[model samples]
Target: MASYKYDIASGAEAFTFNSVMRACTKEVAALSWCMQHGLIAAKAVCSRCAPPPFMRRKGMHWRCSRSSCRVERSVRMNSFVERSTAPISKLVMVIFFWASGTHVTEAAQHAEVGGDGNVVEIDATSMTKKQKYNRGKKHADY
Candidate 1:
């Protein structure tokens, strides 16, 4: 697994079972095992208990070796419900906003992608050569 000893031993308040479960896939057996063995808490009562394979690094990316019956998944894949569509940067922004104690409306305002207070539509034909150049950073110098 991704040896989360850093989180466990950080000396601040440690993650609870609920938080760990939030980061895990809905693999009931593994979740139950974590709860029963106290791996959900810092200073696990059973640290030697094997972690699921998906948490382990096989190469540049982590993946499970079990093809017959998959029981594990990466934290990223497990943590978010709609990970494919949303950009990772946006997800980080949400986490950052949550941690910083900012209200959701302010965060949404800061991360605006579409129009202003009123909808400002754009068209491909309206984009001038200069605008396109600026958009592409064509004037950038090394």
Candidate 2:
């Protein structure tokens, strides 16, 4: 299996291509090359449309090469990041702050994507309202 080096936290570190991509710039190309060369093993398959692919290397890193999948598309094209504008280095820094439990506003401030890259402000109130609505629905069903 292919191997990678990444510093993980004490608790569960969510395994995703984004994390691996955040870890190293070469991880993506390395994993993709590994998959092509049949050097890695598949763990869990994605349940989303087009079924995104996932490869695990000792549970420390992950890669998704499903080019036609939504997750890849979301990471590559959507979200607050542009598809080709921001540098991966800056994105990794943003991910680091996010992993450190910094709030979106604070992270956005640190990202500095507003001036050069398109930075979307996350509305905390909207998220709270959505959570409240979900809770109300669950209670009503009971």
Task: Mark the regions of model 1 whose C-alpha exceeds 4 Å error after superposition.
Answer: 1-75, 78-84, 117-142
Q: lDDT, candidate 2, residue 13? A: 48
Provide the lDDT at 106 for model 2.
70
Candidate RMSDs in Å, in order, are 16.6, 13.9
Badly placed stretches (over 4 Å) of model 2 are 1-86, 115-142
lDDT of each: 0.43, 0.47
Best by lDDT: 2
Residue-level lDDT of model 2, residues 1-142, one tens digit each, is 9999875654234334455444435545543433443333324445574534563243223335455552422223222434546544465555567667778887666556475567669775433323364455433222
Query: Judged by TM-score, which candidate is best?
Result: 1
TM-score of 1: 0.27
Candidate 1, residues 73-123, lDDT tens digits: the string is 333343442355554345545555677687978777655745456575776
Clashing pairs in 2: none
Evaluate residue 135 in candidate 1 and report its C-alpha lDDT on the 0 to 100 scale. Answer: 62
